[model samples]
Target: MLRWLKERLAQQNEAVATAVAAADLVDKRYAAGLATYLQVLSTQNATLVEKRQLVDLQSRALSLQANLSRALGGGYRPEMTMTANAHSTVADKS
Candidate 1:
């Protein structure tokens, strides 16, 4: 289940990136008068929705990971998870 959630999160991240790019394009088009303000607003809304989904998936994945670690009888420390999460976030930003 954790692996599946990770996979879904990765896909959702891609979806969010695509939605953001689309929103940016729509904004530019609207500025040039080639697209309606409504179009720009719609794209921006879609991007926000995608971003929300990504955040949800990330939250679920972290919860599941923590539960798994706890179930494993202290084999994994909470601090270790925090460190790993920080590294992953940095890697993702890059």
Candidate 2:
């Protein structure tokens, strides 16, 4: 499950990148009057939603990894906790 989540997270990151690029293009088009403000807003919103999903998947993957570590008696490292907290902070900011 952790491996699957990691793969999903990777895919989601790619999707977010694509969405961001699309949003940038829409913004440029809007500035050139080739696209409406609504189109720009829609693309921006889509990008934000994609980013949110990516963050969510990251959180899930981290959680799964931590759980797996615990199950294996490897315990949670301080760096791992810190990384998870950092991810949560990013999600909150987003």
Which has the greatest TM-score? 1
Q: What's the TM-score of every candidate structure? A: 0.74, 0.72
Residue-by-residue lDDT tens digits, candidate 2, 1-94: 5567868988998999999999999989988999999999899999999999998988887887788788868876656778989999999999
What's the CA error at residue 89 for candidate 2, in Å?
Answer: 42
In candidate 2, which residue pairs get closer than 3 Å at backbone N, Cα or C atoms, i.e. clash?
none
* lDDT accuracy of residue 41 in candidate 1: 88
User: What 10-residue stretch in candidate 2 is worst by lDDT?
Assistant: 72-81
lDDT tens string, model 1, 3-89? Answer: 788789889999999999999999889989999998998999999999999999888877887787789775686568799899999
Clashes of each: 0, 0
Model 1: weakest 10-residue lDDT segment is 72-81
Candidate 1 lDDT (Cα, 0 to 1): 0.88
lDDT of each: 0.88, 0.87
